[model samples]
Target chain A: MVNVAGPADKIEPSFLEVSTNKYKGILSWLLTVDHKRIGILYLFSMMTFFSVAVVFGFLIRLELIAPGRTIMGPQMYNQLFTLHGIIMIFLFIIPGLPAVFGNFFLPIMIGAKDVIFPRINLFSWYLFITGGLIAVISTMLPGGSADTGWTFYVPYSVRTTTNVIPALAAAFILGFSSILTGLNFVTTVHRMRAPGMTWFKMPLFVWGLYATAWVQILATPIIGITLALVIVERFLGVGIFDPALGGDPVLYQHLFWIYSHPAVYIMIIPAMGIVSEIIPVFARRTIFGYRFIAFSSLAIALFGSLVWAHHMFTAGMSDTAQFVFSFLTYAVSIPSAIKIFNWVSTMYKGSIQLDPPFLYVLSFIFQFSIGGFTGLMLGALSVNIHLQDTSFVVAHFHYVMFGGTGFGIFAAMHYWFPKMFGRMYNKKVATWAWAITTIGYNALYFPMFIMGYLGMPRRYYDYLPEFQPYHVASTIGSWILILGLIIMFTNLIVGMRRGKKAPANPWGGATLEWTTQSPPILENFHTIPTIEKGPYDYSQFEIPAAKEAQ
Target chain B: MFRSASNFSDNVDAVFLYIAGLSLIVLIGITVTMVYFVIRYSRKRNPVPKNIEGNLTLEILWTAIPFLLFMSMFYFGWVGYKDMRAIPADAIDIRVTARMWQWSFEYPNGVKTDTLYVPVSKAVKVDLKSMDVSHAFYVPAFRIKKDVYANKNNNLWFRSDKVGRYDIACAEYCGLNHSKMYSAVQVMEQKDFDAWFAEVSKKAGVQPTLVLQLKK
Candidate 1:
């Protein structure tokens, strides 16, 4: 074990000595145990995977523009959509905000030197990369990538000629990485809180992460087993889900949704946490109902686990079972609505700042509400019978995932970019990106709801000519969305070098993460900060002398 | 491109309209409140806003109201799902097998066809299974979709309340020809369905005859 340095050890040797040169520092960044360094590592890796997956999404949309295989053949189209689902869900969305930003900020937010297990934090990033590599390499294999979709439902998973096993194995491995990260975060939050930092005193972002960690720890193992069973069925001819062997395929749906239903919460809770942070900061007041909002996260997590079977209503479950699941699904929406109302109430008559982060947060409020409402419709067994596996289901999820978690990520990126890189992005460009993305996202997904209601099914490589208009509209919107994303990322990356240097607390927020210097030192905090009040109390700080100097 | 069909289609459409209306009302209410509050209480207008921490009464009201709204929706959904699930006793039975790139339907009279044929107004119960991958049997006109799995059987029944042609497509992604895997549903009058069945059976006679002889 490495020796633990004392606080008095001011000249402690660096973990990896780097030349003062920039490129060498970049190399050191690739292999480091420092939590801050590892967080940036996850950020870049997830962004790369996200970019590739977005390109895949574009290809799928382009193919559907005129209905009958416009851009690619049926087989290629199948691969493209499947790849997009697997990459986006597993590599990007699942770990997108939590693993990257959470790892970077969680310790700092809670006033800790580092995560409770720094080595494990670093290892999670490597495991994520390795899993991503396995998935990427499967695409290059002989028959091309697995086309069983991300769900990899059995029988087809066992029988497909594509490399289904490797891709699923990659997913299973990634699930472990997620579980470990969850376990680490849970322990860090529980055991490593600074002196006098009570659970209630911890920032809402911490509360959000805390709830998500519970979900990760409890729910990921189920998917791990479910994916493992698929692999076993594929390779060993285990008839667990193969009808020829007298196994029940419905069991696979049960097992898969058991984990996946909560996985949706895993994606959104941290985002809610991000919103909680931003809402109060911009409103310049204490959050309206801190306890209710914090508890709502926990409530969503607990209730989210029970609603998985709603996904199985049309898969031939008994009517009684369907009714039960349908009710539970609707019940879960209550907590989500609570969080939304709480956000709006938090901003009620409060001093509101319309910065880039707040803009995206407000966008999330509107878009996620639409998504949640549509979700309630799907939860109704009657409506689901008409809408399941249709473009409506597609629209509902994109609204939640993209509009909810995706916007949350973008907002957090803008909110934290200053702290992470010590630079400011061009506000004008950032605003343009947000506007284009919001409009383009709606344009792409809104028509899906209409087409779904109009009876257009999803996952088809070809469709009747009558459905062409909606597909064309969606495709055009996708192009615009891509353009917005390109501008957003380009501006951020370029701004790293050219933008003005940021102060320690540019937003004047009370979270302990803002206590450190921008682009924090390896130890993070020079002196560990102790929490005194709730995270949203901006009135506590003295007016900056720098403003007078300016 | 759209045409009025029968009572069943009308019922389905009514359900859609009801849901769409409810969703729109909620959307409008939320949007109006959100926009009004933002503009009326802007920081420029009132820089030092109220610092209200928590309101128990408002929280309870929000929670209770949504629960009530959701219950109403659930009640309608329950009735609709019950209607969707209750198949008639005299319904025709058909076996449906979904593979990677094709759908095959087998009728009770021992006739197998690539496309589905059924009598209009007679409920058809499809016992679906998959040969290789999981595929969803989706008939948008019937407003029904069910996942067909390799080792498991899932059955869904629907009556085509009209005599017309409808498109059948796989709703789940399997592989390669997933998009190309299409079929047609020919809903005909009872007499017409029998005639078509007889004609197909006549063409399939010799093999049946040979099997019977071999058994004898």
Candidate 2:
């Protein structure tokens, strides 16, 4: 047996033990079942994945700098874009917010020591890593990675020489991981709330996660089945979607969109939750129409599922299907509109603090509105006929994904930086990063809208001479956008080592997370605290001068 | 314009216009209300606005109104879909096969080509298939798109109003040259279509032009 020394007999090491909890050492972190430690592990892993995917994005932008292929050939370009999409959506955006920040804060917000299923929570992270590794391995295969886009529709996926099976299998595995995390959160929220923390009294972030979790649990299974069918058709010659085999390819689209349309909500709702938390704190007021905002999250989730068929409008769907989908698509916009209304109303007449997080929240509103409106335009059957598969669709999703969800991630990172690292990031660097990103984002996406209006289609490796200028402008703006991201990450990483120690309540928010020390201990709470008041109770904070002085 | 293409296009256009108009109205109304509220309740303008919790009536009204609006939209959408589903009896059948970087169109006369050809002002059905990978056949002018899947056949149809050349492209990403996989649609008058078919048949060494004999 290996010799182990007692605590008192141990020689004096350079570092202090930093003792307090039952867990300690590197192995404690690597083998940790603690939700908070697992969350931190997820956070770091996602950041690394995000950085890798960003490189792919920049490479894509680089290739599109001119009308024709530049650094890479057409085939390589296809692989790059497909891998970029897969990595960004599956590896980053889908799991990025929920798995990292959600796991860390959800339990603490609900006044629980841990999530309802802590072991499953850790298992989800490992599953995520396993899925990510499979995707990475596909890239190393003999024929190279999957050239099929993230959707991986059948027939072509059946025939493609590339490693479609491994790539698709990766997505399928990731979907399972996503479903488990969603189930975990839903159960935790339902069964783990502290005393007096009723539904209405709980924080809005929890509500947002609650809605998102429902979508994850209900919709992800369909995609799982859909992808599995595609893989089976590829290997077994089953011909479920093969036309020559008398199968219906349109049916594949129907099933794929059925899940994908709601998956967009899975991407956005948690970010909305992040925004909800940041907004009330900065505004220093109760959220306007709290019930409306909370219910709207549910409304968006439910309606979001119904609108998936809208993606199939141009896919030779029955006119009746197109009309119904178009109509339902437009209807879904109402709840999203309600959400925007409530966010703006929450800011009305409030003492607003224009911090980095608040700035991102403000930008999210403007960009998300534009994104939502454009989605309405696409939902209209007539406009969709004109804009389908065009640069307009590209611009619209970027506004929602990059502008909406991406900005929300930035806001969350800024807001939670102190809590995660126990150090404050440089505000000056953050402001500059925000300014550059805002300007760069618009410059990159806005021109695509113009090009799309001029009738330039999307996914083109080469374009007509007329569309060249817009392509040039978009490419240049992407570089600027990449620069902003670089600056932001650099600032945060450097600050972790050299930045000043942050106070517990750096933003003066009344949330339970704010009440704890910066980077709380392993158990999260020193003692489980009970909630007796609503989340936005500023009135309780007002004390007499004599009491305030103490 | 309503009769030029298929009835499906007209219905699609109608639903689009209605939704666009409604969305515009909602946008303008929301913006106006927000601006009005901000200026009216500005901190400088009003030292202390009422700390009202919520208006139950307003909440009920907004919720009920959107519900009604959604129901109406859904009704029209369902009706429009019914109209689109009934394929015309006289629809001309064409076979489409999509590959990684190419699209092949096969006509009833056993004529195969990379580009699609159709008579103007006629309902044409395309039975789409894929040789490898999934690809979406999107014709913006026709307002139709369908996925061409490997081993599976999906069909879509449309009628062209104008006799001209239009671009046909693969909407979904397939392989490295997905962007390069593009074809063209040549819409011609019936007489011109017959003559072109006859000439192509003669070139292929067929004794009688299948298309011309069928017309006769």
Docking outcome class, model 2: acceptable
- For residues A1-550, could you state the per-residue lDDT of candidate 2 as single tens digits? 0011123222222111232235678766666777777777888888887888888878877888787758888767777778888888888888878888889889878777789998898888889999999999999999899876677765566677899999988989999999999999999999999776889988888998899999999999998998998888888888688666777767887888888889899889888888888876765667777788788889889999998887766566666577667777867777777777777776666655567787888778778877887786676555566567789888999899878998988999989887777778888788899888888888889899777755577767777667778888998898888889988989999878888766656776777777666666566665677787777765544321111111
Residue A314, candidate 2: Cα error in Å is 2.9
The residue-by-residue lDDT of candidate 2 on B1-216, one tens digit each, is 112243455666676567656766876766666555545654456534334445677666676776576566556655664544456778888889987679998776667778888888888888887776667887755656666666545787788878878678787767567777779889999999888877876776664233323544
Give a tens-digit lDDT track for model 1, residues A207-251.
988999999999999999989988888888876777778877778
TM-score of each: 0.93, 0.86
Model 1, B97: alpha-carbon shift in Å?
A: 3.7
Winner by lDDT? 1
DockQ each: 0.59, 0.30
lDDT of each: 0.82, 0.76
Interface RMSD of 1: 1.7
Task: State which candidate has the highest DockQ.
Answer: 1
- Residue A114 in candidate 1 has what lDDT? 78
